[model samples]
Target: MAISEIQSVAERPEGNELAGRVALVTGGTRGIGAAICRALAGHGASVAAGFSHDRERAEAFRAELAAGGADVTLHRGNVSSAEDCRRTVQEVVDAHGQIDILVNNAGITMDRIVSKMADADWYDVIGVNLSGTFFMSKAALEHMLERGSGRIINISSIIGQTGNVGQANYAASKSGLFGLTMSLAKEAAFSLKRAGRLEAYGAGITVNAVAPGFIETEMLDSVPEKALERIRSEVPLHRLGRPEEVARVVRFLAADASSYITGQVWAINGGQEM
Candidate 1:
C-alpha cells in the first residue's frame, strides 16, 4: 500500500480522549516512532518527540505536525546514555509541566552472529534498547508514582520473540523488555498500594510492551527485495505491516480505556507468531 493510503489522525472520528495529556516518545522523529507521535498528537496530547540525531529530519517532522495544529516539541539526546535519558525525561517534564505517557521507543541494532559480534555491538544494542528503557522508565516512574497515574509503553520487536540469525544482541535486548515490563508493573502496583493510592476505581501507573513485526519502515529499506518478498510470504497476511498499524495499537494502549491492562506484551504481527 502507498504511504498516502494510511489514514491521518485528522481523518479519524475518534474523540480527543488524550486532551491535556503529555507524551514523551523516544526515537519519535521517523518511521514507526513518527507514526506513534502522529497518533497521540492527533488525539490531542502534547507530544515530546525525542531524536538522537538528524536535526533536519526532526525539524521537518515538527514543522509538518505543527502545521497540522499539533502541539509537539523536539528533544535531542542519545538514549544509550543514562544521563542523556534522564535529562531528556526532565526536559519533557520541565517543558510540558508533567508527563502522562512515556513510550520507550528508542532502540538500535548491532546485528551479527553471536561469535562474530563485537563487544561494542552487544553492549551498544543492550545499552540503548534495554538500559535506555530502564533509565527513561525510572525517571518517568518517579513522577508517575507521585501522581499515582501514568503509562509506560516499551517498543520491543518480533525478532525478540522469535530470535533471528545475526541478531543475537538485538534479540537479547528486545526480549529483556518482557522481564522489565512485568517487574516494573509489579513495582508500580506495590508502590501505589504502599502510598494508599491504589483505589479500586482509578487507573494507577501501568507498564506494558508492544512488539511489532515486519513493519514497512525505513529500517527495512536496506533489506534486499528478494528477502523482503520472502518475509512477506512468511506472514499469514501476505503483506508487510504498516507503521501506522503499530502506532494505532500503541495509541490504544496509551489511552485511559486501557487502564486495566498492564505487564503484558501486545503483539502486532498479523498472525505471524500464532
Candidate 2:
C-alpha cells in the first residue's frame, strides 16, 4: 500500500475511543492554535482552548467547534501568569479527570532591533513565549506524570533557529523552547522509568515542539504584500503553510500513532530551512 493510504487509515480516530482523552491548547482561539484545537477535537479528544482575551471570540470558536460534534471548552487566562496557568490547568482537570495532551502554543512577538528595543519589549516577548511555556508545562506535568502517558507539543518558530533581523526577542524566546523540549523529554523519561512504566514510554507521554515558518495568520496580515511575496518566493515549496498543516502535526504527536517520537522539533515551513 502507498504511504498515503496508510496515513489515511491511521488518521481515522473513532469518537468513542478518544472520548475520555483531554487536551489543553494555549492561545487556541485564533490562527495556528485555533487550527490545532479543531484538529484535536475532530479526532475525538475533548479540548480546552485557552485565550488571553476576547472572550467573545473564544466563545464563538467554542460554539463552532462544539457544533461540529467535538467536545470543546474555552478557558480565559494569561499564559504568562503562573496563577492563571494553574487555574487553566485546574479548570481542565475539574471538567475532565486528567489531561492527556498539552499544546503550548501561546506566544507573542515585539519586533525591534536589539539596539533599539526597550527592555520591556524584550521582557514581554520572553514572558509570553518562554515563561508561558514553562508555566503551562509545569501545571500540566503533574497530571501527566500521574497518568504515565501524555503528550506535550510546543509551538515554536523558524525565526528561533535562523535568528531573524529585528526579531531578536522572538528568536530568543523560541530558541529557549527548544532547550525546554529536550530537557523536559529527558525528565519525563526518567520519571516514567522510575514509576516502573517503561512499556508506557511513548504511550505515557512524549513532549515535542513544532516550529513553523511564514504562516499566513493575523500576525502576518500586517506584513507588506511585496515582502510577503518575497518570503513566499524564497520557500522551496513556493508558498506559506496553512494553519491546518501545523495542526495535523500536533494531532499526530498527541495521538498514539506517534508514540515513538519525542523530544524532537518538527519544522513545517515548506522546506524553508532545508
Candidate 3:
C-alpha cells in the first residue's frame, strides 16, 4: 500500500475502552511512538507523550493531538537515565492522577558492524533501547503496584528475533526486551499475589513486548530504493508495516480485555519472520 494511503486511514473508532486510564509513552513525539500516543488518546485515554529533544516538533505533535480533542500532554526527558525515567513517570502521575499504561517507545539505532562499532555507539543504543525500557518499566511499576493495575508495552523490533548485519547492538538491545518482559510479567504477577490483591483487582498490570518488522517510518528514509524493494519482496504481504498497525496491537494490549495475556511478544512484521 502507498505510504500516504496507509497513513490516511481514519482515526480509531471513538470508544471508552480506556476512558478513565492514563498513559505515558516515551519517545512519543514522532514515528511509531507518535502513532501509539494518537491511538491511545483516540481511544479516550489521557496521554502523556515523552520526548528527549526537538522541542518544536514535540510542541507541534502535542498541538495536533490536543486539537483532535485528545487529553494529551508532553514531558521532556531522556529515558536512558533512571532519574529521568522516574521523574517522567512521576510527572505523568502528578498531572493525570494515575498511570495505567506505559509504552517504552524511546529508542535509538547506532548501526555499525561490531568490528567498526565504537564503544559509544554500542552503549548508547543499549542505554536508550534496552536499559531505557527497564528504567521506565521499573518506575511505572511502582505506581502500577500501588494501584494494583497497569500495562507495560515495550516496542521491540523484528531484528531482535532475527539478527541483522551492522545492527549487533540494536539487535541485542531489542532481543533483551523479550527476557525482560517475561521476567517482569512473572514478577508483577507474583508481587500482586503476595500482596493479597491478585484476585481483588481483575485488572492487574501486564508486561508485554511488540516486535515490528520494517515499518514505513523515517528510519527507512535513508535506505536505498533497491534495499527498500528487497525488504518489501521479503515480506509475505509485499509491503512495509504501518505505525498504526503496530499501535492497534498496543491499544489491544492496553485494554482490559487483554488481562489474560502477559509476557508475550506480539509480532507485527507482515509475515517477515513468522
Q: Against the true structure, what is each candidate's TM-score?
A: 0.94, 0.93, 0.94
Cα shift from native, residue 119, model 3 (Å): 0.4
Best by lDDT: 3
Shift in Å, residue 11, candidate 3: 21
Model 1 per-residue lDDT tens digits across residues 147-242: 889999999999989999999999999999999999999999999999989866465788999999999988898899999999988889999999
Clashing pairs in 1: none
lDDT of 2: 0.89
List pairs with backbone clashes in candidate 2.
148-204, 149-204, 150-204, 150-205
Separate clash counts for every candidate = 0, 4, 0
Taking all chains together, the TM-score of candidate 1 against the true structure is: 0.94
Q: Write the residue-wise lDDT of candidate 2 on 158-255 in tens digits.
A: 99889998999999999999999999998988888898875632365788999999997999998999999999998999999999999988987887
The lDDT values for all models are: 0.91, 0.89, 0.92
